[model samples]
Target: MTANACAPTYSLPATSAPLPAPKQDPVRTLIDELLAEQQRLQTPVARFSEAHDRGASPALEPLYRDLIPLSKPGPGEQYAFEVDLDSCTGCKACVAGCHSLNGLDDEETWRDVGMLVGGTRNHPFQQTVTSACHHCADPGCLNGCPVLAYEKDPVTGIVRHLDDQCIGCQYCILKCPYDVPKYNDRLGIVRKCDMCHSRLAVGEAPACVQACPTQAIKIVTVTTHLNGQPALDTTAFLPGAPAPEYTQPTTRYTSSKPLPAEIIAADAATLRPQHPHWPLVFMLTLMPMAVGCFTVAACADLLAPRYPLLANLPASAPTTLALTGWLAGAAGLFASVFHLGQPLRAWRVFLGLRKSWLSREAVIFGPWFGLATATAAVPLASQLGLFSGSADVPVGSVSSALASAYSLLAAHYSLLTLATASVGLLGLFCSSMIYIDTQRHLWRAAQTIPRFFGSGAVLGFAILFAAAPTLPYFFALLGSVLFKLAIEARELRPLDSDDDTPTASFKTAQMLTGPLRLPHNLRVTSALLACILAFALTRISAPSLLAWTIPALLLASELTERYLYFRAVVAPKMPGVVSK
Candidate 1:
């Protein structure tokens, strides 16, 4: 109903129509009384739930108590999700169902089914698990996103991804252990199971549940006093994530197998990090590495101002590279927007502060980068004599704009400078978290010093490599070497634990190319040693092979470590185990 479309605000002085008291029709009066009571009760519930979710609840807080409020399903309410694991038969009917139902593009799915194989090898049985957004309570996706595009229905507890509010960073993919978020390369956005909330609001089951063959999927409300709990049979395919804290996932899986303890154990350490996306790291750090590389090149040129050609190059170089760098960063960032379910309306991010850092970061990011980018071009303008830096201007006056410009530039660059340092560090943090947070001893080794230092060194050297022609980036390469050593040290350390996982991984890595470690390592080490000695004999002058060899050895080791890392992940044997 349209707002203000109802009766006037002022109450009429008690209706003087008592003479017409409708002849006191008892049945009609009783019906009117009953309808009024029902409407009164429902209207309060509806209002409170909506208001409470928006954090503006006075009446809602008490009426609903702790229940979450869900956005009402769209008009013509029709929706339900149903699943039967026993008869699922490991087929993927629902995936296609979701794709078609949601008008998802090719290579996109609104729902999917994963297979979990268990029951001791001899009596192995495969369970086909269908899945989509559980619309979780305490959704890892919701918590981990830097953008606040997710919403939960107070009544239904249906967590929703608001397409219009998303920027498509795909951070949700990492935050979710189920691997639900799919990267739509074409759209340059991260898409996931939207839970068919729209359809559900309109009284329909999610597309996947509707499409499941054998009646394997179903919608249910397994109610108890507690809220946000999934329906009794509902299960998610989360791998290495938190325990089901009754986040009230609406989608439930009916599995024949009992839940495992090991998976639950992994969840303790693997609850997704609050800052999983690390927007600050990207904005403040990574962007600068590229920018700083250009900056350093600019400085190097500035230092050699005596060289006419070099000085002229510096004048435009910063501007040109700054523009290019911004473009690349912007391109990547823009592509990220299409990943949102609703791209056109993304400004909702700035509305919340205390509850959302994503909004906070986004609110500041564009402007911060904008100011920083312009500040970067300032020295360039100075080069062109656009304005004299030393020109006398009144201090403390907005007229000069100096105070304001200084303050703004200073404020902007603080975060922007931080962006530079933390980019690689945050990426490392993510890499470490991926391994450290998971339970596999083999994978956890990634938390060791080697990975920590090595990744930084490798990335640093890569930057150096790109900027090699101008001047020395040796310090960067030196970092690369130290990191390489750390990698070696991590490998040499005894398997983090004697779990069969590490042993299996090592054995697998060894046998991957026929036989095992001895052959693989021996071949690699011998070739590398030969090359190193040959270069040593060549006196590091003519070939410049020294530069290549250092990274090569470091790279080879990194590749080997990566190979092991890949082998180390222990996938629960399901017919359709998730892997990227």
Candidate 2:
């Protein structure tokens, strides 16, 4: 079939001047008009921006007029949270608002609502207390941060965390009496309420302040000092909360009705064990062990010249002890890295040395480690003939000078050992101070100082006796272990007390005997086993076996003790609901 056959021809019947336009439907016309109107309308965000650009007040301004301060703080004053205890309903709306507005994690909340209960049976009283960062005049978190991650604004007095600067050491968590800083596992840093400083800067109420239905939360300017530094009046700070004298907390919790003197935290009786911090446990245990080893090595080296027994011992004993000390110190220091969320950023840990004990510990340990390494290396190098000259070489050759210098260094190695041990002792003191500064009852100077120094002495003597199998070292180890055990036993005395008020010390006793019973028992068993092993070393023909075994037992005991050190201590916190 051709194209012409398939196609049909058509002829025009009439000629037209123009074609008529199609008529528009009423519905279509109305829809087009509505679309045009919609295009001309401004979005809510755009309207908000326009309103601000026109110098108009925000819509919520009227509602939160009295919720926020109208001006910046004056001289000797800073911003603080002021919550009316009478108005708090424990609804946790402030917590929700804080979480949402700050885009916090699902489980993270900067604001918390806690309950305080007390009073006689007839007049039983209960109240919910809303709390956030008090923006203290002397902030413990700021003081204790190794990298200076926290800073208090000089003008506003809001303590702010520098997220990028944080190494996620979590020391601030221990430092804060109120437990304000919340660690963010995802970000590897801690965060807390800045009193919504960003919002307050722009004349807007904080999220919690705005979210309160009853307007119980408000921002106010308070005097930071009365006569001298840290003299802020903390009388109005929440009762049944952590003592405010330490940090000079500025948050005011006021009530129309007088609170009962017997008011106590709802969770007061709860026995919540804290994180064991395995890395810290090992670090604390092993570092002190290294220090002890160094101490024994130095003492042995110094006494060997005068004492026939020490001199008659193996010539390699001092070198062996120093090497062991170096190895332990290195391992302990390396273990500390695992505790950091950002290990690479730990170089900045020295930034807080002026204020933080942790910083001091880190700084002191670095030099001590270097000195220890050198002490260990020099003897090994001499033994390997690294500084020795060839037998055929002349007496005045460069190798001879090197050998002579090495000999001089070897002769004076004890001085280096003494110096290293001294620095290590200082480092251990800093370590003890790190916890002591937290002001926990269980970690007071009386308990912590002896525990730390005693562990060092016991482990040090145990290691020395292992190396040389001497009677003096054996007795020293036994005495130190016994003393340490005695001090630790003091912690358990409260367990047998007739009074059951659940005080901090009593609570610590409960933790040791209850959930932590196994570890506590193991600690004691290890120590006793070490003492038994030491005694057996005197009778056994295979003294070598007992020599190594005693130190192992002592190490196990100290590690368990360190674990319990962190776990049994009852950290101070705000009162909240009873735990299940």
Top model number, TM-score? 2
Write the residue-wise lDDT of candidate 1 on 446-474 in tens digits. 44335444544453343334323223344
Tens digits of per-residue lDDT, candidate 2, 156-195, equal: 9899999999999999999999989998888878889988
- Say which candidate scores most in lDDT: 2
Error of 1 at 69 (Å): 18
TM-score each candidate. Answer: 0.50, 0.87
Each prediction's RMSD to truth:
15.9, 10.2
What number of clashing residue pairs does each candidate have, in the order they appear? 45, 0
